[model samples]
Target: MANFTLKVTRLGFCLLQSLSPRIAGKVAFRLFCVTPSSKPKGEKAKRAHAAGVAKLADAERFRLRLSGGGLAHAYRLNGGALGRRGRYLVTHGWGSSSAYMADLATTLAATGAEVIAVDFPGHGCAAGRALHMGMAVKAIAAAEARFGAFDAAIGHSFGGAALIVAAAGLLPGVPAVLPQKLVLIGSPSEMHWLFKGFGKLIGLGWPAQQVFENEVRRVTGRRVEEFDASRTAGAIQRPVLIVHAEDDKEVSADHARRYAAAGDEVRLHWANGFGHRRIVAAQPVLDTITSFLGEVISDKDAEIIPLFDLPARRMSL
Candidate 1:
């Protein structure tokens, strides 16, 4: 039924494109920006959600008002009288909440580093139902204001693009701080690819596609292609670790190559078999990220010590 409904919707968009390209593009653009709800429904799901929250009950929960006027939810871990090595800011991808990133954030906190995982606009516990890269940048700036400068920022998928854009400090009035290092897991390198792909998915014609692109430019004050992470790689000039699986069905591994090619310090880790979502929580990937961030686990911290071997090797693009 869902597949059939999607096909009918695509057909409707195609007809609308024929009648009025501008209107069709506007509607499609709005649909494209809408994020799926992360709130759990039903008794079993709610119970699972509660369990996940309880796992991080020790975290210091907080919120920040973003420039977009929405409350950005975030939580701080390992912040109470612990010897800190560094501070890390973490962000989740589209259709996901900070709960999904709790594993990585908790592990980082276990290393005695202060870790704060942010729920971006329209995601997790944050307010709103729509999100764009611009809004995401504001969320990062808001978190930085509340938490101060971070030693590193880690993002998965959509979150990765937000981190790179915020680090670039290209957007006006955002005043985002660039982190010392970055880790991008299963992230896209270009907004152009995502926009064009969405257009094709909804059966938008050339005229409709142009209108959609114009809407993006008007909202962001830049072309969709300009949102490329590879371009930001040159501007930030910071150490970057790109963990991508070759078998990823969502964002292609080529996106990882784009960043590696553009930056001298970018290292690409081919974490095969984990696909897109699981790659974010895989033990090997987590270990590689910790090593990149200069984290050294002591004998006393058995919980933070990694059990998986680091998987780092060169792959032919």
Candidate 2:
């Protein structure tokens, strides 16, 4: 069934690509922007979501609505402490349910900090056919309003890009939702990388690609180039911890390096074997990230520098 679905989807894309770039671009924008729900990923993923929620102490679950009938499934775990212990928001990658990130969210909940997680539109129980950066940014703001400001925001893949956008004041509300501490795992530095790769995979020409990006600009009010994390990373003074496995197959590990290069105290955690998705659920990765989160929360004087692991055979740049 999965193979058949893949083949059919491919055939549909081929047919779409055969059309003029303008028409194809508009069609592609709608198809790609729409998110399929999180129902398809199977039992293990479902169990993970349940387990993550079970792990949360005093979990508060709710639904949030956005423009165009988009919805977000949100979860909140209050800080173990009585008073204000700070709140942390967790957002997962594209095509990923918030359940996929429940592990980290629950783990953060173990600390005294309030932990929050949300399934973006078209992910998990959120009702939408697709998701785009603009919607993701809106979701972040919505989460902020419901839970108050975030002390830190942890995002994986697309979530990281949204965080950068929120921090950079690139969204609708100037100063959208800013987290004092930021964590980005396996994040893409630029949308050009994603669009270019998708274009090649589907045999989309430059004209189609440009048209698609133009459509994105028209819908989101932001150009593709503006999504680059490195472009605005330098100005964000908040301490950042970027973890990317050397073997990450999706977003390049260099994204971590580039983010660090953009400056403002980025600590890169270079894992050796864990790929993009696994990096998020890895125990060591979680420990490293939570440690950084704690440091920023507890130590006013904490400082950091660039970090990465190079192949033993290759000389460091």
Candidate 3:
């Protein structure tokens, strides 16, 4: 019976591979998959876990109404008295809520940076449909309104792409709240390739891939062929850090390489072992970010305030 079950599983995978090469590639990508490191285990661990869970639940329950876009909700974590320290705005990926980033945010805040974790539309406390990149952009703007301009912005996956658009001065009519520095975690330079690879993984064929690409273009107002982060990376004019896991099963490391090729201002850090989402929680990645912040903060002569110095308060919102 065990042998039969193994045979069936192998056959199933083979069938999937044959159905879509992109899906097959996704499977190949999954071989490098790394789950997020679990929280510590102990009495203190239990208490901490419980507290974190409770805070997440409470944040989810709190709802806020958006003026033009309709009603939505968000999780607002006020990092205790960073005082005059700088602020960091964090955005999570698709199918994930702000809760997933709670660990990362807490860690960064502990480093004397004010961290605000935002829930994109339709994912966390925010209302709406899933994968709505436009709404996600708007939600980001709204969050900025509440928290003021961020010194640095970090985004994972889809959020990374949105951040790129925001930085490129693409979102017209929307208030430009570009961060002094930007970090793209597990972000792909080519949207078409990423989507195609993703669709293939889920057994999508040419027709499905094309349709999805069309919808993406319609929503973003950018064609798949024209969507190149390398070109846009130069326009950012801010120091950009591109961090991706070598073993990432989602966005490949090649994406990071392409982004690096685009400009000299971009910095690429490849962390091993950690997969897409897990990279956020990985200590090494956190350390890199912390170190980068330290260097940027120390370099006073630098035109761009190295994401560490807290900006003066503006009376007008």
Candidate 4:
């Protein structure tokens, strides 16, 4: 049924393209921005989602009203240790909620770091049907205003892209909420690649794609290709730790390579077999992130901290 629906949807777009490319492009772009449902499907899936939510039961839940008239739900976990390090922000990917990030948030919170995880407009408990980077940025800005600047931010996939863009202060009117450090796991380097991928998914050819790009520019006030997180990372002087699995099929490892070449302070960690989503909860990835955040290097003590037994390599450039 899902396959049939998808085929029918594709055929509808094809017919629309034949009739009016402009209208087809507009509809395609709107459909492209539609947020996926975060609700659990079956009984087993419901149990798993309930478990994820249960993990955040101890957290102080709150909501921030976004400038775009949407509300972002957030969960704040206070540090367990007496010597609190600092506040940290954790943002999940598209089609994900703050509950999904509970593992990482709880881990960070356990080690004396106050962690806040947020659900962007349409995801999790936040109410909305559509989401874009602009809305994501506004959500982050609202969080900053409510809780103040975060010392570090860890983002997975789309959340990472939004984090980089918000930190870079690329979009006008929205003030930058740059953290002291960053962790981008399985993130895309630019927006055009995503747009191109979406084009392929919807069977949109060059004419429709051109119209889509024009619509993108109208919405973002910038060319689709201009939203490069790698370029933004280089421009904004901050230490960034990029964790990417060599086996990440959803997002190419080439994106991580692009980020590694972007700046001297950027460090890339290669994880094996974890793919995109699992890498978020993988022990080695978590260790690497925490070490990156906690490590203090003096001239005499400059050496790589020994992490987990996982086959991982770190590149400092």
Cand. 2 Cα-lDDT: 0.76
Give the winner by lDDT: 1 or 2.
Answer: 1
Candidate lDDT (C-alpha), each: 0.82, 0.76, 0.66, 0.83
Off by over 4 Å in 4: 41-48, 79-85, 295-317
Work out the TM-score per prediction.
Answer: 0.87, 0.84, 0.71, 0.88
Candidate 3 lDDT over residue span 119-196, tens digit each: 665665565554444456666777677767777888898778778776675644656568877888898786667666
| Candidate number achieving the greatest lDDT relative to the actual structure | 4
Candidate 2 collision pairs: 33-130, 33-131, 34-129, 34-130, 35-129, 35-130
Give lDDT: candidate 4, residue 297.
24
Q: List the residue pairs that clash in candidate 3.
A: 23-200, 23-201
Q: Report how far residue 189 has shifted in candidate 1, in Å.
A: 0.6
User: Alpha carbon lDDT of residue 219, candidate 1?
Assistant: 72
lDDT of 1: 0.82
- Candidate 4: tens digits of C-alpha lDDT, residues 10-54: 899899999888888889889888998889777975775687799
Candidate with top TM-score is: 4
Per-residue accuracy of model 1 over 1-317 as CA lDDT, tens digit each: 27898899899998898899999999988999898877876787576567657767888889889874767899999775764347799998888878878778888877667898999878778888988888888889999998787878999999998999899886777886788789999999988888888899888999999999888777766777778888787668787889999999999999998988976878899999999888877899999988888642223432332322111111111
Model 2 Cα lDDT, one tens digit per residue, 121-142? 8887677677888888888888
The lDDT ranking, best first, is: 4, 1, 2, 3
lDDT of 1 at 20: 99
